[model samples]
Target: MAIASMGTTVLDCPDPRTLAAFYAAVLGWETAQDSDDDWVELEGPGGYNLAFQRSEGHRPPQWPGTEHGQQAHLDLDVPGDAREEAERQVLELGATLLQGDDGGRRSFRVYADPAGHPFCLCYPRPQDT
Candidate 1:
C-alpha cells in the first residue's frame, strides 16, 4: 500500500499574486486560490499545484553558492527541439536566465523567477530502447 500522495509546492515571495501570475503564464496554469494577499496557488495539469506565501522580507536565494544558499528549485521539462522557444517564453514571462545553452554539454538551463527563486528548463532524457 502507498503511504502518501502528492501535494502542492509552496514558495515564499514578496508578492504572492505577482509570483503566481508569472508561473501561471509559464505553466499554462490558472490561479487556484487568492483569498488573501499573502498566499496564492496555481493549479496546473497532472494534479500539480504551486502555492506562494508572502514573506515580509523575502530575500531571494543566490545560486552558484554565496552566503545565502539555494533552498530549493523547480524543474520543468520540454521536448528536445522546443528548447529555444521554451527559453524565449520563459524570458518573456519574467524569468532571468542564470545559465543556459552556452554551447555546453549540459541538458538543462537555470533561471530565476520574478521573486528570484531558481528554476530550470530541461530537455527530457532519452528513453532506453
Candidate 2:
C-alpha cells in the first residue's frame, strides 16, 4: 500500500456549515461543490482541503492547564520574518491569541478559533535542506 498525498483534514464541529464557512473565510477558499448539511469541505492551496463534520454537543479543548488536554493541534509554520504579519492576519480572521511566551525562548504563539480549537503559529527555523 502507498499513500499519495494529503487529501483532507477533517474536524468535528457543532455546526459543520458554520465552521466550514469560518475556515473558508480565513483560508480564502470556497465551500466544496458537494457540501451537505452534515459535512462541508474547503479547498486548500493546490487542491489540499479541509472537511468538517457535524458533531453534537462537541466539547472544545482546554490548553496550557489542560483540565481537558488537546486531542490534537494544528501547527502553522510561516517564514520567520513573516510571523508577526501572519499573526495579525489570523487575529483579524477571528482567532484569539491563547498563549505567547515572546520573551525570546519560544518562537511560536498559540491561538484558538471561535469554536475553541487550538492552533499554533510557528516561526520557521533554518534547515539544512
**Candidate 2: regions farther than 4 A off:** 3-6, 125-129
lDDT of 2 at 20: 82
What is the lDDT for 85 in model 2?
85
Clashes of each: 0, 0
The runs of at least 3 residues in candidate 1 whose Cα sits more than 4 Å from the true structure, single-residue gaps closed, are: 1-3, 102-104, 124-129
TM-score of each: 0.88, 0.79
- Please estimate how well model 2 matches the true structure, expressed as its whole-model Cα lDDT: 0.80
User: Looking at candidate 2, what is the lDDT of residue 103?
Assistant: 60
Question: For candidate 2, lDDT tens digit of each residue in 2-118?
Answer: 779667888887888887876776668888799999989998788888899888898888887678677888887677878778888888877899998366457788998767788
Query: Number of the top candidate by lDDT?
Result: 1
Residue pair clashes in candidate 2: none
TM-score of 1: 0.88
Among the numbered candidates, top TM-score falls to 1
